[model samples]
Target: MTLKTAQNIAKQFTLVKAAATTLLALALSATVMMQAASGASRVKDIADFEGIRENILVGYGLVVGLNGTGDSLNNSPFTEQSLEAMLERLGVNTRDTDLKTDNVAAVVVTATLPAFARQGTKVDVTISSIGDAESLLGGTLVVTPLMAADGEVYAVAQGSITVAGFAAGGEAASITKGVPTAGRIANGAIVERELGFDLATLTSLRISLRNPDLTTSRRIAKAINDFIGNRVAKSTDPSTVVLNLDGSKRDDMVDLLTDIEQLMVEPDQIARVVIDEQSGIIVIGKDVKVDTVAIAQGNLTVRITETPQVSQPSPFAEQGQTVVVPRTDIQVTEDGDKKLTVLNSGVRLQELVDGLNALGIGPRDMISILQAIKAAGALQAEIELM
Candidate 1:
């Protein structure tokens, strides 16, 4: 072949290779976009159905069969009264009798009655010592009636107390872990009445978002409507999404809710920075942005050390006496080597973190710097101190 024809063929092959590479790159980009879009959360995870919640039930009771770690009768008069009343209920009259018992403790029992709980359902209960009891370990809670806010008994709790903590001590000191005064029993309370709500009779349902955001609520409503092929879901507020079951295509609310909850929708969140000062924890959201700002943080450190030297008399010295001489050493340091880190305008969360990290700033100092940036109106996100 001629050298010119060979050169032309080589050029054509090179062009073809470049075109194939471009196509592969475009395909990879599209795949990444699709994966990112599919990474959204389901509707059930970010929101809760309105009327479906647990009710708090509380009761006062006595925990017996403790190992001499119960309430002192002298200090806890309520314990004495409760003991007498309990004895009377058991057909043993102990009125006006000197009752000295170190095995009984007055306690408060608490449990949560779950939503749609039937009469036979059993729920977990927590028992806490109200008197000055040393521990509730190895104790059995007496029969107690758990009541709701309206002062109506809904369930009865009586079981062995399972304390997660214990205390052991001598006359000198004591050591304790967890909370010996509190305990939990799995399935200790039996539900006696139902919460007076029927989910099947509801014509409409309200979905309350755990995190209130207008964009998220609207997105959820849109996703529900699109999945059902009807405009039955509407965002009434930032935190509420109302579903019009009457206008929905499906007549069964259960099936409709199941379908709606399984629908995946990308939830939006506000740009927020959370700072926990006590624990030195700072969390910056992915959407957090920062305007153009320069931040410089430095610390002044001063250290003082003390040393004492004893000056003793020599063997031949007649008038010299022993004495202690105090010596102190102090050192001061200033971090003047740190330079100002200038964050550019519209910098995202990663860039902001990188800029801060470049200054060798720790979490505690970064919290103060973020607050300062917020005060200066340079941080384009809300700072929530927790």
Candidate 2:
């Protein structure tokens, strides 16, 4: 081939290789962006909408059908009084008769009413014995009206009690498993009313972050705005984000929430190290860091002993008398020589842990050492003692 033809061929090959390299770079960039997006979380998983919550409902009730472990009516006057009142309502005169039975227990029932819950919707209820009843297993809760804090009845609960634990024994010895006095009734309470707010009529909505962080709040707002292709979402503070809904989307509030809640956003977290002294548990976060610090551990032991000695003079000496004297001895010792080991500056949690582990220290000693480092401003994370 001619020299000019060979040069042209080389130029063509170079152009093709450059195109391939550019395509590979673009592909890698896209892959990285996709991976980052996959690791992000939805807005609803990290934040809760304002004014949308559960309401607590509580009520006093009675449980019947227990085998033989019921509250003593004599000791629990309220239990007897409640039973008497219930019986009187059922067209029975129990005031004259000494109604003594071991098949009844007084219980406090509790349930939660979800927001926008309609009438006739069932909710789970929990029953707890308020008296000295041994167990609530196999008991059936009576028809009890659950009331909210506003003194209005919201639901009625009634069903067979299902206890997670059991109690069995005699007067001298007994064995109990779990908490026998507490039980639950699934789908026991029916909603009698709904809340006052209407979602379709709402012009604005707000989200409250579980953990308040300025960067997270801004990112959430930006993600929502970008997803909707408008600047409708705004971060009001570190914990709150407010959104303005257009008139066209007001009728489709459910659809709007569905889209907004699914948008992904990365969240920020504080570096923290949590320690449970009782359980000797140490949890170090990945972002935790430490500066150069020295640690030394030592143990001191003390021992004491007592001895009684008898002193006697000559048996026939009138001026001498037998006597007893107490003698005591004390000893103290310390193990291991004191040596301060200098730990290099650690920029990662693993490095700090490795340095601490090299000292052959336990969790309790690690907790003390971490606290000392934090106090000395060597640790770059917050220390939480549990």
Candidate 3:
């Protein structure tokens, strides 16, 4: 072969090899992305349907039949009055009766009325002592009407209190387990009136994200629209995704919604660091990063000690007295084992934590260091003080 022809053939082979390598890289990248998307979560796990929420119902009730653990009638006049009124309603006249008893306690009953609850459906209720009742164990809660915020009766609660704890001892000292003044009754309250909300009659639905994020909202909208094979879902804001339901039959709405809810989508999260000052807890998100920064941590300790010495006159000379002489000593110490640490840019959450832990930094000290780094513009994530 001629020299010029050989060079030309080698050049062509190099170009072909490079193109093949690029295609392989692109194929690997696409496969990795598909694997990542497959690990996404279902829409129902991260978002809630608007207008479908529980309503809180509260009521004032009385618990009776305690074993000397009830509220004192003298100290809790409301308990006595409630018992008297209950007796009167039961056809027993207590107009001139002086009720004095420690077998009853005034309690506040609270329960959550779930959405779409029909009449006669039973729900759980929590009983908490409003008076100074030692325990609610083995007590039966009287029939009390639970009311909503609008002052309308929604349900009635009456059942034996199931206290998870107990208090027992003589007047000396008592040891209690769990919470003695609170209890719960499973399936305690029966629904007397529905909240009057029908999901089937709605023309459109709104999906509210639990943690608002613009990227997450868009992903949710796309997931729903793709599932239904139409442009039915639109992200209105970072927190809300609106679904257009016009021209859809009522029976189809349920099936469509079920499909939309089951669609899996990847949700985006904000890079953040949460620290609890009181509990010394630090939560660092996986996406949190820190820029290249140098850190120097050293502890300075100052200690002041006082010594009292007694001065006495020898042989008790005339007008001589004993006095206390105070001596003070101050000492300052700086830890010399600390060294300057240089963290690289784009430091991952685990790397940053490991670097800080290498310096024997506790959560309290780490909090201060993180704040300083954020102030210096080295920390690239939001710091949430909790």
Q: Write the per-residue lDDT of candidate 2 for residues 1-386, one digit (tens) a residue.
A: 99999999999999999999999999978966884776678788999986778999999988999997789888888999999999889998889778789889999999999988999999999999999999999999999999999999999999999999998888999999999999999999999977788776677888899999999999999988887888888999999999888733346666788788877788887899999999999999878988888878777889989998999998688898888999999999885765667777866888888778777788888888899899999999988888
lDDT of 1 by residue, 93-153 (tens): 9998998999999999999999899999999999999999999999999999999999999
What is the lDDT of every predicted structure here? 0.92, 0.88, 0.89
Please identify model 3 stretches exceeding 4 Å from their true place. Answer: 1-39, 247-251, 304-332
Best by lDDT: 1
Model 1 ranges off by over 4 Å: 1-39
RMSD of 3: 10.1
Query: Which residue runs of candidate 2 sit more than 4 Å off their true CA positions?
Result: 1-39, 247-251, 301-339
User: Global CA lDDT of candidate 1, please?
Assistant: 0.92
Of the candidates numbered 2 and 3, which has the greater lDDT value? 3
Could you tell me every candidate's TM-score relative to the true structure?
0.88, 0.80, 0.83
Candidate 2 lDDT at 241 equals 97
Give residue 142's error in model 2 in angstroms. 0.5
